[model samples]
Target: KGYGSGGKVTHANVFIGSLAEGTSEATLKDAFSPYGMIKSCYVRNKGDQTYGFCEFNTVSEAEAAIAGMAGKNDWVVKFANNDAWDDEVPHSNVYIGNMTEGTTEASLRATCGTYGTVESCTVKTDTETGKNYGFVKFSTQAAASRAIAALNGNDGWTVKAANNDTGGGGGKGWGGKGGWSDGWVWQPGPSTRNDDSRPEGPPSDNLYVKDLPPGITEDEVFAAFSKVGQVVDCYVLRWDNLSACAALVRMASTEQATRAKSQLSGTIHESCFGPISVKNQEKNGEKLEDHVYVKGIHCTTSEDQLRSIFGKYGTVMWCRILPLPFRAGAGSSSVPDVAALVQFASPEEATTAISAMDGKVATEFGAPMVVRFAEEKANAKRPAPTPNNNLYVKGWPVGFPEFLLQSEFQKCGNVVRLRLLDNPDPEYPTCAALVQMSRVEEATMAVTALHGRPLQVPLPPMRVKFAGKDQGADNSNLYVTSLPRTMTESQIRQSFSKFGEIERLKLLTQQGKPETHALVQLSSPQAAAAAIRELDGSTPAFKG
Candidate 1:
């Protein structure tokens, strides 16, 4: 009624048995589609009868399908054999090798059917050598064992348990190919040999992990290992003869590899496929730390720009932008941002960069950038800072007109200025901006009225808050540098007005000195200090 043997169903695999001859994968998919989302539908043929496994996205979906379709159409539906899901090395599947040119999936099934019920038969050709090899999946381990014994040598083919290299006769079976060839070993099957097995030898930095769940990605494996230690690289290997995948993860050092092996080996991953095997290999991995992951970088931003922006903290060794795997929509091909990883010369530099850049919106990208160690996951969004006359608005739909945002803010108070920006946070596919209201009261009113509500219906709610700092709260006079030669007194006042009301602004020219300096006084000392902090060493490019 519920689940057989295992007590309760924890996975999404649903076994459908006693299928009619004409039933196909599409039929099973249609039957289960109404229940929930299906990840995969597989129909295996055994002579005249057929069976199938339908994998749903959740266990509830599978349970719904089982309950809905159990008695109808004379089909036997239940949770798939938990043993099959729990075991990485399934004994029911046997590997058949050294087959001649005349072999086919049909012939292999026919030959194996004499010993047991052949659930599925697959024959594949080597791309490089053009040699044919095949595998037969039986309903039970005893059937596979019987087929391996009877068909091993009688048909001039090497047959053995897929997980075991030793045939019942003690001959070289599937395990032979798993032996160390040069330095790399084929995965899916367990490795029968390890070159680094010597206890006295130095540990290796590379770890070989096999039996990863099908559909597991390289980035996922990299992330998993990155949590244990620094990951230099991750490679996922897929073989035609194997259902699951394998990975070669290179940690930063032998010590890290050892830690990864100890922590991850035989541990169940989120995929729920099964426990994976992690063993050390002879290859050397890279080194750790000083790597910072920066998210919410504008797509138009480049590695050089990242280097320039982060260079103030310390020396940047390298920077790279990671491409998005897919677009949000078919028509919306342009992405706002791509995340990047920056390598600093030291962990101190990396930490300093993270601390300074984490929630601060870059000048070019008004979106707040999230920074953390490459090995760490992204933290929760920061709380809004103290309120002021300047408001930071984000989450308006991408391509939303700047006039609309200003107009929306104008309802609360006089809109002094609004600057549109590209948001790089993948979670919010929208634009962001810095809005300056004429008064602090108006800015607070705008945030209160529109903080969690959208300007337009059906669009995501816009986030409104005061800019991180009230720049003029601390001082009244600021000595500003890097003013262009053509800049006038009025232009300086206009450029600096966003911080607060300007009391006085003057461009000072000294005899025989090339650099021009501006002395500005704002009504609010906090605003003056904020301006000083924001524009201390930068060239002031006055728009008007």
Candidate 2:
């Protein structure tokens, strides 16, 4: 049981588990010997069954091998300190999961390489069929943090960072993705190959718009712009009584939008009721002073032509042409012709385009295009406060539902207001509540009795002391309680007199027996309250 200090057991004994089916104990020892000295290794086998442990000369040597071997897949390694032996082994790697089928060592290295140097990249695959289930390996803490942040919770994959453990014959391991419930950190993955090319023009800021024709849906709008470029995402905003169709389009570039807007503006789709306009939305709360409105658009203009024409401008973020409703008898439909929203990079560029072509005739499209800044919406009114003084209370434990101040002090006076302070931060509990009384005297009396009771929430609990009473008080009447049973009155009075003038001390007694509670008579009630509140729950022994 006792391996000498220098002969401490090695980590190889605990680190090797579920290794590749035919791996020999000698091979495992050889792999881990580089990390530390391997005194002896034994592989248990019964009719070709391979499972066993290795012993190292020292505990530190074992720990080093354990930490380095974690997250390794080729040789399933699970290492733990021999608790019965009183040795400790620190873990140093984690598991990663939710990888794409196409994920390879090269791709993972490229993705995680930016963080730090990776010790190993092992993808666990089916032993018989060779299908990837997960990956694990060793890396510095900094690199692990970065990998977790970047790969975790990605659109297609999930990345987790945790300690490595060993078990089972299959490569399926626990830790990062499958074991932990906390969602993965977010790190953007590489864009598709098609997305590598730069846009034809400048980039434009995305704009979120509302207030659309009720009948118009996202599909109808996408069809109108499908020819231009790729559409990222589109949705219709729904409210209680109103719905607004919105679309987010990722064009070739900002320049493409300019040409697209010019060509598409004033163009009407057969289904649309009016000309569609386009303008850029501002970012970081910037105001949009200039706008471009396109009118009289031809219904049949293709998205390519639209982009080619408007792309002449500096850049266009996105362009969408509204369509009209279908007509039963007519070959084409034309009913709801509403406005179109366009986003540009800057107001100056938008204004310049508006000035050059506003109300101008379109040679290719035929219909005149009208350009103007869009109107802003009006602000809604807020409701008036309640007539009765209803104090807002927060910051009280939900279980202890009773309002401590309101219930305890309401009987003494007309309770006009009472509430607890609610905190958004979860670490701090609801410690204090507020109470307002009809009469100032009642507030003063409430502050005196329950200022430092055990049941009262401690973080400066709710008290009703007068605002200016402190300035007029002489330091003589402060009450202290919960003193150690061994403490004496003379020692208590002497210890508190330094704060202010302590007139006398009254130690509470039960059946004429001395009690731990004591009330020191300070010069004023305010001083007494202040003293009690300050020193109520401290642990230092009372000194005269």
Candidate 3:
């Protein structure tokens, strides 16, 4: 049937595409008014580009537009079931580029009307160039996808599917140009591929060991591989610590790491300190390559403790107890410390040591030691900040919502106010928030606790102080507003406990003689400072 001419429009949703630059919601409604009553039309902008979405009165009108202009040039139309609207909808938006100067929202909707129902359209002009590059959002993903498939890689104007909220594509740009590429050329960047093996030639490098314990040094590494062939080179990877010395023994050929796998794997070298195992490096015929690292250590703790902890996990290549670093201040520094690095014959062993003991306190040291993958150091200049204070937190659990900040800080003291910073644009949200405490001590405590913690929202790790005319000395006495009417004093107290001790709390109410917002007082300035650093301007109460 003709567009919206049949019985009451069946589809409440419709998609619009092939919009010209500078279209707007009012113009879109006027353009589509002839078919039937139009609902809301939404046109949005991306930088200088225009994009958006719109709703219609009937499904039949939507379907008619789709069928009539599925592959039409300049503009295309399609429809999607209302249920398809979600974070994952594909090709629901279009980007319009290369518009003439002085283009406005009305002009854009008229241009797009030639295709089908004109949803909201807008033409955004770059202030610097005074050029138009905007976007149009369709009511249905199907329409947007149809437009993109038809117009992509065509000609004059470049059109591609808009990146969806959940990150999908829309139609290609005008003239059917500017689309994604599917070619393969490797440079330097993150790779999604798992296997990276070359078809021809031997593997690049072989393994070698040297500087073993003088007594069993040579025989130690070779005895295990006697069946394979003669050992090529045997030495130790030396460092200042003699006890932590590592042995590198090269097999006659790369094949030895695989051929002597069984015997060399379990053979233990008897050293002054303890026994070490030998093992193959890799498997032949397999295209994959691998590397190894070793670590194991003991101090006053017995060798049995080391073996019991690390032995069952993986094959141990070598173990030694290196002397501790020399003290700096003359005679006072003369105390022995226990340090060791164990090299596993295979990477699996090294990984096991790291996984199991890397952070464990093997001896009676203060904190757990760190273990990580070693790599060559490249001297590259650090990146400059992108005009914003973005902080990165490391230890917090993922997906923690922003609301939890108040609860986290409640342990220390009373929170007077909290608010998350508002981004200038809704499409581009920011990560940082602001917090205020009743006491400086509470704020300080929060600052300390949240200093290295990951923000629930994405942001850099640094905390920004509250902006005020004075800008000096902490403001501990403060209040928060817009709290949910259901909130109680006990909940407020609990929320601020992490910051410090709360002196008192007063919830604002219209019934009270003195109309005031919620007020909280803390015991010390430290707590107040902590609260201010971590909880300011992020909560609903202080969002305004």
Candidate 4:
């Protein structure tokens, strides 16, 4: 709804937008509820626009969430209605193209008015040939964003960013998520992404070059800009109120954009607009695709620590580590997933950093971590989970509170359910528990890392295993890799028979060729774990 200057940061609440499908209010509460005594959390949606508003107990808590979520994930988190991101730019400017040959500006405004208020709409005409392409300039960025979404790729019209600071859509603002539009929406230059995947760093190859000598051909634009980077495509575009053609150059990445901007901008052009202004096709005052989203940040980690590690690849635009959000009202004291977003000079630099930093988690309080591409929409991924969300923990220190017991297990993941029975009397002696994690991969990881952990006072090392009722491969099945090339399934069964009963044996092949791997199902988990522990790396020699 018309974003007025009402979202005050001092109020301790922020607006989050573009939530992925399946993201529930509970998920939002679980993720952000820990930031502080969360006052409340709620989500709303219509069509592709889904968003939420959350309030924290303190400004510091809200800031912690903003810093952590800003560049880190798919959800758009911001100081609600603060107008910080909606910078002061031309309010009523837009570029609309792909029109049927005879359409005029008044016709566009009349048509676009059906979607929202249209301040100015026009057809850019060639001064020489009198050719006109469609364009529209709305009253507010919100109205413009809505108009573009409604009008672009519809019938024969296409919309893009306008080229000047004249204003951001000149009419009223829209009421949907993220204020309908931000800098990333459009900027009169190259490679503007109005729709599709979440916007990342700046447009790498999109170059905004203006004041070209009148009637400059695409080849001429390419030849001049190609010195700094490979020019994928170059074309002259006409924007609203502009009589001369402004050239748009597409570079492959930010590195190219920077190089082209530095070398080509400000050059003398014998055109009506005077000397050329070569620069990035930018919105939001930053390149949309040059930023990288990072996760697994430790509480002990600092921004400088991140800069030091990530900067090794290239110039780091910015690196910020946000404190993990915390929720006190809880069933389990589950720790939050800490994260940050680092912007690089270009997308390639970000890709390089990801390759270098992923899985290299050497933090103070936790294990080594891998970085993630900050996604505006949380993608559907299992990461490292199992088929079912459950785990079995076989260790019990009697007298431990159920919450604390859940906390210990929560170190690995969200604990959905826990069942524990203690045996103190001589009549019955057994101490064990079952923990069902919120995700299957979390359960798998818990089983992998905590199966043998000793917590200070030693009663016995914990044994964690999957508790999936019947979802996993049948108990009679085991996945064995690196078998001798010529080994057969029967041979594998014969060799592993030392441990227990083999229900079945089968060799896996690729494209009709037998591979050096086989799937064998034993009678039980104990047998499978034992066989794996004993013979996984043995590599027994065979008479092949």
Candidate 5:
């Protein structure tokens, strides 16, 4: 049924196109009911066309109907657009590619017309290449989004918004979750970097140049590299407070890249850099591998925190933190800082993260972090300590209502504590939470039942597992570092004193370093955990 302007759609609704002749509401229900519990089903007529919608008990059910009905019996199934009925919203024009041979404008219009009013449709052939492409303009943005959602990546046809200005295909101006914007879909440029796992064609002839002095520009880099080969592109990547920077120079061919790398390796560009290292970008090898090794991690840091931090580079597949007492090797137990291995979807993303986060001394991270390529299983990981009552849950998008976590975890057992982990990078959408259950059995139940279970519609399944041994209930001591040498012991106590009584606060400083490390023991484990919660990554106000 058509919705008036400003009408909202629920996530559990599925839109059905090309309803069969003489089909009734009962027919739609009968077709979809096998997939899930159907809340409502109806067939509606607009003008001379007939369509239908089926509302299931949950979004998963609706998706099940789409998957089961799609490509069977010529059924066109997609999520119903909440804004589909609104005529006042901005309309969209789509760019369609990879059309089959001899496809006509009439056939294209017929396909898109099933989703919404096709205001105009056109097919064109590249005179020079004979490649056929087309465009479909819908009366409303919602209609175009629906058409793109159903047709994109289907039968080899690629459909997407013609431009970002249009309110279609996950662009701005779409009011709410509807059509293609509801779940993960395609967009363009850096904003859509979340799904870098998709094949992006073959590797290019790129060269990685490092040790360039600060303030190097793309033109400067191009001028230096172009002398040896035809330069396709150059990018100087930098971050705040960085002493030296790096650049990526793309040559026209791999042979040119090889020649340049062989000749320019360890050579200095007199104008812009010191003894620069020029190597084939792909040769760095890290750019082709997806795992990154992170060290100097604060003991209090969570895996979700690392995921969110590394996510700024690309989508993180998973983050595994090896808490103290859990080291790369048995002999490395003396290593004080925590360590983690984060895996991203793409090697390029992992490389980008290493470039950005390696030796990064940010306050939020609690210390300067060491990031680098992780050789396959570089650090042997031990299974998390079992019989653990604390659970670490992940797989929810950022900005999810954290308050809902307490109530949600209560379903399994008594929640002693619930803390939603922080994401320092605002742009990253993945988040995690830490839940302290009253009993080990309840935590096990949570892991068994909630792992891979969908808690919220349209969001990915929640990943629940036991946390590291250091995060267990019996731990009341905090291994804190990165404190200013002059900060004094009383100051450290005062900063965390509000949480509880400080039983012992010892500050240690190395001979040459400007920072000091501290070992804080509170009156109770609850007080220590509370102190970490409040001060883990924050700079508290300390008066002189």
Candidate 6:
């Protein structure tokens, strides 16, 4: 009879005991499916092994399952803990890993919750190291089961239904051991929350706001919200089809974000023209802002002149002039834009500056500074294929799928991993793929034999080559140049901090070099990949 916290009781869970060593969750679900409506079912794991448990929509369905399965299968199964949903359901947490650099918790919950009700989610982080892992808890066993079935080992992540082990984090266990200890975390707060107060959402530290008037610049928006807390990053998006703009802002902490959203939503700020809607930042279609990208300056425009024209709004961090392509190691090309980037103290300032200067002509250049935000990592240019046992292939048959590719690659050797990417580059976009062979020799062989080979009739020859490696032998250390002269080591470090932990970042000067060079060391290779992939061939303005 003990069903819910107080009154709401919709289902009863069943426990299947003495399961065979190899028994899986699908076997249990099928055994009980014919009896009645199944809510959730899973094989409980002691340590890397599955026992058995399942849930039915009601006591009647559970009874039917118990009566039908008794004396039939070679297993002992019944309601878990004698039908204790409260005791067992809280432990439905799962561990998710292999997230890409810059994966946010809001993104994880939004994606993982598609399978079921996510009761709680904890992203474990190593504060000292800047590495992250995650634990997600679903309300029912079915939710956990569905997620594990669908998301595990997909998208570079390893997903598994957490066990009662110390690492797995049992019923009392929160996030995995030694992780999330005073780390950034989120949890649903008090249920008795009032409507006028901070609104309820999956508790997160970031906030998103929409319906910002065009006239209210990014700096003004930042200044208004800075009243509540320090804004980490703010990106304002304006779609050509939409009349009004929207913004996403990350706060210093979850509590500050929640408080500001509750207080600011439905209220018009002093400089704003309309009521701005404030809520938790969603993972769906979200973008991160580092610096504003600017173009359309006259070739003669100088950084000091541009800064003077734009310095009225806020603190001008640094002004960088985009270098023209050099010719024969002597004179540079006659490019129209020396595109001076006016870096502001914060993204909010950059937002306002772009909103104001994008269409407005520069005072000295006699042309408008085509100010715009840079493309985010996802939308940014894709890296050429990597040279791990992985091979990059393009111009494959249009309709041929991944399984077909895997089958063919197995002929040469074992196909460890294979993926095809949608062409995103505007100039040379096409169907592209990456395949990791079982061994380096196998990769070499596949490249040798498969280069220019035909996969299907009437299609372009399959182009198989080793993906070009990053300019550096390893991306862990990045060599950079053309940085503004005013940028200090701290400024350079701060500019690259979003990618990951910086082990060491410093400036190197050489006698023959036209500009100073910077070398950056990231804690992990993944972080380096993220930096190089997002920033190669692109210029970013850093503030002092």
lDDT of 3 at 495: 54
lDDT of 2 by residue, 1-544 (tens): 2121112222123546666567775687777787765544445444655554555544446667777877676555554343211111122234666566777887776666544445456666567765564554433333344456556777566666444322100112210111101111111112222322432222342222222222233444444444554433344332111112223433334454444445544444323232233433344666464435554444323334445566576476665544422111100011122223344566776776666554344444321222111222246333433333233333234324455556777756678777665544322223346677787677666654443222343222222222221323443344344443334444564556555754444443211122244545555666666766666565423321
List model 3 lDDT by residue over 1-544, tens digit each. Answer: 1111111222345555556678776765665556555544555455675544445544445445446545644554455334233323233457766666666778766655433344456677778877677676554444454444444555444566554321111112211111111111001111213222322223311342222221122333444344465554444332212112234444555566445433433223322232122222233744211222222222223334444455666765555444333211111101122344445566666655555644333332211111111122357433533422222322222223445666666666776666555334221112345666677777667755665333343321222232222233454443544344333344455556677655445444322111223455555556766766666654532111
TM value for model 3: 0.24
Per-candidate TM-score against the hidden true structure:
0.26, 0.18, 0.24, 0.20, 0.20, 0.24
Model 4, clash count? 55
For model 3 the local lDDT of residue 509 reads 37
lDDT of 5 by residue, 1-544 (tens): 2111111122457888887777787788778889987644556677777888776654557768888998666778987764343232233678889899989999999888766556568899989889899988664455666677678998899898775323223322111111122121212212222423433323336666554432334445666677788775566654211123456776778778777776765454433211111111243554437777765554324455567777888998888766333111111101133456787898788888878766444334321111111122335553535678998876444445666666677888999988888756332334568899999999988876675444642222222111122566665666665554334444565677687655444444332333445666666677767777677766633321
- Computed on alpha carbons, the lDDT of every model, listed in order, comes to 0.56, 0.42, 0.41, 0.50, 0.56, 0.51
How do the residues 1-544 of candidate 6 rate in per-residue lDDT, one tens digit apiece? 3221111122356778777788876788778899876655555557765566676654556767877886576666555553433432223558887677677788889887665556567777767766677887665545665677678778778887564322211112211111111111111111211311433345555565653432223444565567777665565553211123356666667677777776666444443211111121223466323245555544334456557766765687777666543100000011122344556677676666666665443434421111112223334543545555878776543334578777767888999888987645221212569998989889878876765444432211211111123443344656556543323454555557787666544444322222344667666666776776666555554321
Off by over 4 Å in 5: 1-26, 29-81, 84-91, 164-544
Better of 4 and 5 by lDDT: 5
RMSD of each: 26.3, 28.5, 26.5, 28.5, 25.9, 27.0
Off by over 4 Å in 4: 1-289, 320-334, 364-461, 468-470, 474-544
How should the candidates be ordered by lDDT, best one leading?
A: 1, 5, 6, 4, 2, 3
- Give the C-alpha miss distance for residue 48 in model 2, angstroms: 16
TM-score winner between 3 and 5, please give it. Answer: 3
In model 6, which regions exceed 4 Å deviation? 1-11, 45-50, 82-137, 140-544
Predicted structure with the largest TM-score when compared to the true one: 1
Better of 3 and 6 by lDDT: 6
lDDT of 1 by residue, 1-544 (tens): 2221212343567889999988877788888899987655666676887987776655557778988999789999988864232233335668988889978898888878765556668899889888788877665454565567567886578887775422211212221222111111112233323522423223567666654543344545665777788875676664322234467766777788888877876554443311111111112464345777766544334455667877898998887666554211111112223467778898888778777776454554211111111222247443546768998765555444588788789999999889987555332224569999999999989877875452542222211111212222444656555443334454555557678655444444321232344556666656755676665554454421
RMSD from true fold, candidate 5: 25.9
Tell me the TM-score of model 4. 0.20
- For candidate 2, the TM-score is 0.18
